[model samples]
Target: MRLEQQPLSQVPEKAYHLPAGTAAAHGYDLEVTPESAGWGYSGLRVVTLAAAEEHAFSTGDDEVVVVPLSGAVSVEADGSHLDLAGRADVFAGPTDFAYLPPGTTATLLSERGGRFALCTARTDRHLPVRYGAAADVPVELRGAGRSSRQVRNFGTPDHLDAGAIIACEVITPDGNWSSYPAHKHDEASATESELEEIYYFEIAAGPQGQPGLGFFRTSSSPGHPIEITEEVHDRDVVLVPFGWHGPAVAAPGHAMYYLNVMAGPPHPAAEAQGGRAWLISDHPDQTWIRSTWADEQVDPRLTGERS
Candidate 1:
């Protein structure tokens, strides 16, 4: 039950993008605190819309999750049902994801400079919202090296894919270290529990911008460990649960882009689906991590999300 301490720039940027960790993302133009400032739920933040204004937002108490961690956009809640989508791993990667529920009152349309990562979850109730992403919902990337994949969304298959969300998109090579020892699904009593997490990062270097970003925290045991590898830019966020949540995002030759937003309270045998039942586990100490990264090679274009 940790990860309490938010303050990534105080949140207050109508049209702002300046958190340089990813070396001033060129085509990326980052933005990290939308509707969630350290987990409180204030003025409804998280903006990175490059040019296309129809302005009309309402929903201030929280309860929102408009995630699109990369490309595609076009929403219009109440504005007149005009949905267009792509993101959550390019519309289906890392286990498909996309939802904007709480009340409504929305309008976000992207022309071309689309690179999203918006997720709001506070809850109050806005009204008049929007979202549209029809056709081509076939994302596939079923594990290899470091695995766990399942994002199959067709058209609100049942909605509720996940909200106490623990997102993902990890590409760790170079020395390898993906979520080591550290463990804790927050805690929700029987039925699993405690889950309040968020970690956003995008790093790319190796032919020039070397030094890639790495190292994270939540450890002080199994031999006392607490380190934060300096060098992390591009929408930086480290809102972990508690101690023992180790080795997240490792880079030594560039190639690490993290996007993990999680929600807890389910799992532990409480039954009823048990959250997601650990999803997939076996990380006591893979001998130095990398348990099996043999050179790794998962990039079938890496963008369109397994089209």
Candidate 2:
């Protein structure tokens, strides 16, 4: 199936902030193209399907990873089918995912209603389609105290065979902070690897199913200029091409979950010298805050269990 494309300039004036349903297209609840982001590499599309319903689409010139956010899904591409055992929710630990290379047509089917995320990147190179098991995903707990957060490294350089794309998920507990110290990867150097990033957030609802809220911020870097500070809700998106980003604060009443999609030129030399990984330059003014983690304990709510 061909995707109904939209012009990039047609994106809302608030370039960084995209409310739920604002970027909808075809069967997707949120569709963000490279053109829409005004960047060259990273993009994302989120789709919600009903019981026994299926959605089909082509990858075109981009490669995508099919990740089930709330339910199970079967992904078929290039005559290969991968059935994913997904978690009940983002807070439910890790979920299996499938990767589709460029020029491949794929279909996603769910027996019961569910939501899925297609984390994508424009690429000229075509890789092999494959499956990623949740059992192999690395869960890392970073920072301490209120700065604590859980990271599921399901699609990182050392974990998957993605060409340029590097994706992951982060879970921050209520009243806690993640992405602290304001980091930047906008410069291409031995210390930093320039990359474009997309942040898709989902605030956990309250006990009575009340909606939740969180805050996101992105400030201007040395030469790169960008300024964004907004209260984010379910399905909200933030695009970061060049800037210092951080402190995605989950409000006291709600836990926050965000899917991070990143892609850019690979630095083989830097990898051989150091290590192939996402490198960031933290804001010097607040860099000292990291030391305080030694005095605080991680939030007890970070129980890495899936049901």
Q: Pick by TM-score: which candidate is best? A: 2
Residues 1-307, candidate 1, lDDT per residue (tens digit)? 1234454334332112223443233232443333333443221134466656333454434335455555556666654555455553432343232455565566667665355555544433332343323344443343334332223333221333432333444554444555654455543444334444556666665696555666565533233233333445545556543334656645556555665555444445534432433333223554344434345554343433431
Q: What is the lDDT of residue 89 in candidate 1?
A: 41
Overlapping backbone residue pairs in candidate 1 total 53
Q: What TM-score do all the candidates reach, one by one?
A: 0.30, 0.92
- For residues 1-307, what per-residue lDDT tens digits would candidate 2 score against the true structure? 1132344334443777888888898768999987778777788999998998999999998989999999999888989999998889988888999999999999999988699999998776677899999999888888888888999989888787776788999999999999998899987786788778999999999999999999999888988767779899988998877789998999988999999999876655544422235888999988999888878877788855321
Query: Stretches of candidate 1 above 4 Å error?
Result: 1-64, 67-75, 80-99, 102-108, 117-181, 189-192, 196-205, 208-245, 266-307
Best by lDDT: 2
Candidate 2 worst ten-residue window by lDDT: 1-10
lDDT of each: 0.45, 0.85
